[model samples]
Structure formats: C-alpha cells, structure tokens
Target chain A: MNPDLLPLALGINRVILYSGYVLLAGTFTFWSLVWPQGRKDRHLLILSIAGIALTTIATVAGPMIDIWIAGMTWAEVFSPISAAALFVRLAALAAAAFFLVDIVNYPIASWRRALPLTIVVAIAATMVASSNAVGGPWEVVKLVATMGHVIATAAWLGGLVALAAVLIPRQYLAELDKVIPRFSIIAATSVVVLLVTGTLHALAIAGGFQELVTSDYGIVFFIKVAIFGAMLLMGNHGRKYANGVALRAAAAARASKEAKINHDKLTKGGPGMHSLAVAMGAELAIAFGILLTTSLLVFVAPH
Target chain B: MSRPQYSLPNLRRFLGACVVTAFLVTAVAAYYGTPEPLPASVDTTSDAAAATGGPADQAPATVTIEPEPTAAGVELPSEGPGVSEPGLLLIAAPLPDGTWDVSEQVMLAKPTTSLTLAPADISRAGSQFGFARPEATSVQVSVGEQPVVIPEARVIEQVSADIPSTTRFEISYRLDGATVTTVPSTARRGIGAIMPVTSGLDPDLPVVVMVVGETVLSLSCPELSLSERNCGTAAGDEAMILAEPLPFGAAVVAAQIDIPRL
Candidate 1:
C-alpha cells in the first residue's frame, strides 16, 4: 500500500467499525430500555445482524492494517498485547451472538436479556481502552473520559437509530405515546454524557486553542463538533414533537366521549409525527457526518 | 382514524440538506487549515531545471568545511574553511582507546523559520542489514553571529531574530565514536575501512566529507546498487562523496578509506 494513503484507508476502516458498534449497541439499548417489544421487530433484528457482521469484518481487518503500516514481520504481528486484544474482541462477539439468538428465539426473562448488551459493552470498553490510552500523568483521567465518550455515543446514536426502527414502520403507532417519552429521556441523558466526555476528550487531545486552529486534526475535530451541534438541535426539535404527540394522546385518553376517535387520529400519523420523523432522518445523516470526521481524526495526528 | 403515510421524499430532502452542510464545512476547513508542505522533502531543483531547459546535472553539491580540527593529528581540509563545489570533507581522528572520533561540517540553505539538525528515531524498517548511519551526539548551528540553540528534540528554531535571505547555516556534529569496518582495498596495500556519515540536510545533492588520519592511502565511494552513482573524491586526508538525489528511504553516505597503518 502507498504509505501516504494508508492513513486514509485506516480512517475508512474506523468508520465501518464505529458504525457497526453504534448499531449493535444502540439497537440493544433501545430494546432493553426504551421498548422491549422492539426485540421482536424484524427491522431491529436486521439492524443488529448488520452490526454484528460489520464489527466482525472490522475486528479482523483493523489489526492487519496496523501490522502492515508498521511493516511488521509475520512473527512480529502476533505480539502478545495485540493478540490478547483480538482474542478478547472475538470471544465477546461470539458470546454476544449467542445471546442475540437466545433473545430472538426464546421468551427469556428480563434479567437474561441484559447478557448480550453486557457482552457488547465489554467489547466497546476493550476497544476504547486499547486505542485511547495516551499515557501521561493524566492517563487515568483521559482513559475514563474516552470510555464515557464511547458509551454515550453508543447510547445516543444507537438509540436514535433504534427509535427510527420503532417509529418508521408505523407498526407501533398506537404505542407511540409510551415509546417516544422513554426514548426522549434516554436521549437527553446520553446527550449530557456526550457533552461532558467530548469536552474532556477535546481538551486532552487538542491541548490548546492554537492547535485546534492550526492542526489538521483540530480542524476535523471542530467540524465534528459542528455536526454534533446540528444533531443536538435536531434531537431537541424531535423531542418537542414527541412530547406534543404524547400529550395529545394522553388528553384523548382522558376524554370519555371521543377517546377512541382522537387516539386513532393521533396514531394514524399526523403532521407532528411526520415532522418528528423528518428531524430524526436529518439527525441520522448528520450523525454519519460526525462519524466520517471521527474516522479522519483517528489517523490525523494531533499537533 | 386514518391510515399511515410514509413520505420518502421528506427523508431524502433532510438527508440531502445534511450532506450539503457537511460538504461545505469540510471544504472550508480544508481550505483554511492545511499546513505548508515540508520544504526539505520537496525537491524543486530538478523541476526548475526541466522548466528552464537546462541539464539537471549542471547543479552541483555545495560542500562546507569547518576550520577547527575535531581531534588531534587530523588536518583541516587543504582547501581551507569555505564553501566549495562538488566535493565533501570528513575528518576521523583516532582517540586513545582505538575508536575513531569522526566529524563533518556542511552548509545548509536557510529555512524560513527553523531547521531540524537530526530527526528523532532515524532508524527505518530494513535498516538492520545496511551500513550504520552516523548519530549526532552534539550539534551546533549558527546564522551569521546568531547562535541557534539545538534543542534536545534535535530541531533548531530561530525564534529570536529574523534570518537573512543570504544566510549561510554552518552546522557541525560529531559521529559519536564511529567504529571503522574493515574492507579489502584494490588501490593500495593497506587496511581499508569504511565509515558511514549521516546526511544532516537534504539527501538530494548531499555533499559529505570524511577526514581519516595522514596514513590514508586511497578512497572510493561504492556504487549504491543500481540506483545511485559513485560520487566519492579523495585528496590528501579528506574524502568527499556526492551523488544524485536519493530516492525516499536511502540515507547513508559511505566512503572507503584505505589506511596503510592504524
């Protein structure tokens, strides 16, 4: 491979890896937390399967590219630290797959449902810990911040996608009142986590304002932050629309004379629901923009 | 009381808007934030030559000699301390413990702000089998009367003063206790030893000089396989080697010095 192009290739690989992680983790979080009924939904199942497949490809490809960039020999490629990390990721993926099958095939208990998510979380943590550890006096703090950043990203982005899977088909339109409120709460909390951890990560990595303005890594970071801000505004708009729908649905239920009529009207997909869906679609697109910038950031060294 | 409506057009519009916004942001960032290309690596000499319809080989390597002898019994270049064309000068003075104290001086063109005297971690992949390049133990750089500080990081930044356009950078560095490797000499009946010196400045048109002791009988720069030409010149105790601009990853200047006696 051309040495100059290796970094770009690595960045593209990271995008695929990150997308898979987000989908797998987000879908699972949505099912377990916001809407358990989504577990049976075929769309959610397909998204989860897609996540697993992408992650599997990334897990294998990531190390091979790294070894090639370093120009390592065949024997050197199997160094202990790298081998151990790969083994852990593969093992966790296998266990997560088994749990996913159990969740789909059997009517398992509430406690048993958490197993797959737990395994995926372990995988995410391992990936974060291995890549994000910039050793220094603040090493522990940076590691913790990066860990929080990854989990929060999974919850927010993943949850947004999961919410789409729930909302898009209009299959669960009658249950929109129940679903939107739960997801809004999770989304809000995840946003707060993302802001805090992202700030810490930016401070640690960029070091100073001059670097942010001057360095390639810093410019990409600012672009990511801009996209993130756009995503946030869209999320807020979606929340307001969701709250309006939920409130209208509740008011209809309270009216004794025309409860069925009003509830059915709300469930049938009005202008409010349509607006919410549009906002969500926009947010997903911008989320992908953030992911692309993030992939570039991984290869572009900080000044 | 009505049926579900899925508007594909609305979804497409939102996605399109996001894409346009992202593209704009990236374009702006790229335009404003890209760094100036590294001057050392960008060789414009050949391109300029090609554009001017002149032979590229007409431009010769610039060799700089330092006045002070690095060790005892080693003579300064016979041409004296000044900028000379198409030749190199290196000096290797023998210490009490039998190791050679090798040193070289080169004049580099002034950079806009700073110059890197020695790059950190010069070891490249597949370097183990090749000749050992010289490592700079200590380096001194000056532009006219202004002494540039060589940081432990090996970069010499001229922060305090403006560098003149006609600035001549005199850089001297010791090759920490260079051990000579024995090689058979065809020119004279003596022990032939080859010493590899580091190319501190641009590898393109590098002029390296080596000064072995007065016992030196002959010198030759071996052809660097099929890629590089022999550019070694020997007169008295000094050996100068000049070659074509090296391709990426080739960084050693080896000169075989035959000494009749150690």
Candidate 2:
C-alpha cells in the first residue's frame, strides 16, 4: 500500500518469476534432450512447450503494446484494450505453467495422463489469481510477466524433475552417458532462455530501473536473483561433469570399442548421473518456491 | 522412461467436472449474499411524491411579522433641492414592501404566503393561520403572483384602566440618521403601545415585553416600517443589553416567549 514499497514488491515478483522460468525451462530442455524417445518426440516437447510459449508470447507482447499505446498517449488503445490484453496474457501464462507442470510429470508414453490434473491445477491457480485481480493496465502486465516466469519455471524445473527422476534413471551408465550430454545441452539452453526472459519480464512489470533500487519488490527481486545465481553455479557444475568429462569418455569408449574398449574412468559410478538429477530436482524445487512467491506478488500493487 | 498415462477423453471429463463444481459453489455464494439498505424518511418523501402523481397544490399558508414602530421615521422636510438635512433625526421608517419588487427572485421552489406565527399569536390576531414555520407553509397561488401579500386591515387593542404617570418612563428615538425624532409615550385607553426604545435596538424586529399590569406587547410589521429594524443584527439580541426598569416600569419583556400550540 505504501507507494515507496511498491517497486520493491514488484522486484520480488520479478525475481520469483524469473527464477521459476529458468527452473521450468531448464527441466524441459534437460528431459527432452536426455530421453531418446523425448528427443525424437516433438509431441512430447509440445505438451509443455505450447503453453509456455503462448504464455511467454502474451506476457512479452501485452506490455510492450500497452506501453507503446501509453507513450502515444492514445487513451483509445491503452485505456481499454491494454488491461484486457494483460488479463488474457496472464490467464494464458498460468494455464501454460499448469500445463507445463503436468506435461513435465506426464508418463513417457501418454500425455493424456497429465491433462486432467493440469486442467484442475490450471483452473485453480487462475481462480486464486482471479481472487486477486489487478485493477489497472500495469497490473495486467505484471500478472502476465509473472505467469511467464512461473510457467517457464514449471517447464524447466518441474520438467527437469520428470527427466532426472523418471527418464534418466531407467537407463544404465552407458545410456546415462548419452543422456547426460543431451541434458547438459538442454539445461544450458534453458539457463540462457530463463535469464533473458526474466530480465525482460522484470523491466516491463516493474516499470523501469527506478523500481529496482527504490522498492521492496526490488529488494525481493535481488534475493531471487541471488538464489538464481546459486542455481546457475550448481547447474554449471552439473553441466560440465555431464557434458565435458563423462560424455567425452563415453564417446571415446564407443569409438574405441567398435574399433574396441569401454570407458570406466569417465563415470566412476551411477552417482554422477544421480547427482545431476538431484541437482536438477533441487533447481526445480527452488523454482516452484519462486512461483509461489510470484503468484503472491502478482496480487500486490506495482509501482 | 515410463511412469503412467491416461487417455485424453478421461482428462477432458475431469476438467469439465472441476469447472462445473467451482462455478456452482461461487453461484451459491453470490445468491445468498445481501446488500445494505438506505434511510426511511428520504425514501418516503421522494417515493410518495413520485408515486402519487405530484404534490397537492391547494394547501393554505400564512406569515406574520412583528409590527415595527416606523423605527426610521426620519421626517425629511420635503426639502429644497439639496438642502441641509435636520440634525436630530429621532424616528426612522423603512421603505414600504413596494420597494425593489424583488419578489421576482428565481427559486427552485414556489414560496407561498403562509401564516408563520406561534399558535397563540394566530389566535390573538383572530386568524387561525395554521402554518407554524415558513418552510412548512403552503398557499395556493396562480403563477406570476406579485407583491406576495397585501395588508388586509390593522388590528387595534383597547386599554380599560387609567394609566399612571408614576408608573411611566420615557426614551427618545433618533431617526433619519440626524433629524427625524419621536418622544416615547405611555399606553392610553383607546389603544395599546409598545415599550420605549431599548439600548438603541431596532424597533422593526420582533420583541416580547410585558406592559405593567397589562397584556404583553406584540406587534406585526410585515412592511418593516419600524425605527428599531435597522439598529444592528436582530432586535432580540440587542434587547439583551438594554437597561432594565425600576419596578414602576412596564412588565418584563423577552424574546422567544413560547405560546401553546393549541
């Protein structure tokens, strides 16, 4: 309610939103790349990707259009449609996130298994969000951005969980070796996507740089970023081990063995794969926490 | 890796059921809720007039003003053009009701000529003008009524006993600001008179005073032709600062003397 605290609140919302997106995107990238079936199954990718993409599109697009309209001082455009666009975008993002979570958890062969739960969760989340509707155009923008962040997270983190706990474990060390490299490629892609998407979302929803240092939302944003920094460090280590050292050893063995031998020195045991999976899971869990906070931030007034 | 999976049709059914349930619950909450209500008198006044097809226009009304003693009776000598005015103006009389013809003032309401006097005054004036206050009064009038009211006839009061000089006191009234003047006199057998000037109070404004061993003085000055009307503020407020008389002076005079509604 305090005007001074508004920017800070926005910062918090942004931080959580970004954190969630990274987690979600990373999760999806890892699993889709790691699983032999997933890498081939574009349908599987779409189960989460479609919703997340729609959310991102709406979130990113709605605000830009609104601001452009405002900058033009065209009340005819900004005054009415802007707020509506924001809400529609918000709903899409939340739906995308809900679907993303479900898709990430979807059993390998049948996406239909996750649909019902996703439908329920998406509706419930939207309703709780609806219980706290944003009154003005800015609020709509904030909601959409928050949604993007959250959905991305569900895709990266929650999806990663599905990959590590469900997909990677079914394979032995050799298959794990192949899967780890793919997971590495996907995770790396997700991290970059998350960071970029997060920054854009923060800028639009919080207004500008002024909100970053001057508001409570800004402070919370800083904390989320700090957590994200830790997540990045952890992801980097997992990526290096999975992609750099171990996968190379496996590739060397494969090349030599068909000509000849196996590679044991590269993966000491299953622990490397297990550890990556666990790290990814930790990342996902953290992302979910961010989602919860972003959801609350979306309900608050922005500066 | 495989965990579990279900068909699309089943998922669709689940979603439909959840949406329906939430909708029904929300509808129930809205249906049971109530809104607060507004005040009764406000509703009655507005509603009754609207429902009844306009207010009744036949209500009679009246207004009664205290008689002013021609307080500014400044008898200007129908003077030579620009002649010096008199020095000791005692009594001053105000302009008559026919002055500026200001009754043409615009108003949201049609102000009626209503009898506005205490019940006892209406009874004493021998006219039962039933209206108690100006706002509550109503009177029938064709549109474009002018001068509002015309004086019907002045009332007269008769004294029965001989007046004693021993019980009298005198006060002088200066009027027309400098020359016109009047000497105070006691009530005589043929007519009743009001008290003398009090602390330079306006004579036109309402006053309540007891004439010694007689009925209290009350006068109506709808014309505002009185010396005291111009003193300052209300005649009633200034009367408070006036010097009181010895027991021999006329009876106690006060404003706002309550009369029985009947």
* Lowest-sum lDDT 10-residue window in model 2 chain B: B180-189
Most accurate candidate by TM-score? 1
Q: Model 1 in CAPRI terms: which quality?
A: incorrect
Candidate 1 matches the true fold with a TM-score of 0.58
Candidate 2 Cα misplacement greater than 4 A, ranges: A1-133, A166-173, A176-193, A200-207, A245-303, B1-262
DockQ list for all candidates: 0.03, 0.01
Backbone collision tally, model 1: 10
Tens digits of per-residue lDDT, candidate 2, B1-262, equal 7544556744754564555455445434432431111110111111111100011231111111122222221123232111222111111111111000000011111222232111012211111111111110121112233222212211112111221221111212211111000000010101111222222222222232221111111222111212221111112211111121112122111111111111
- lDDT, each prediction: 0.53, 0.34
**Position A107, candidate 1: lDDT:** 43
lDDT of 1: 0.53
lDDT of 1 by residue, B1-262 (tens): 7443545544544554465455445434433443211111111122111100111233222222123322333334545222553222345543322234554443444434544344223222112112223245456556667766655513222213334443254555554312232200011111122332323434443444443443232222232441132333333223232324232124333332222222
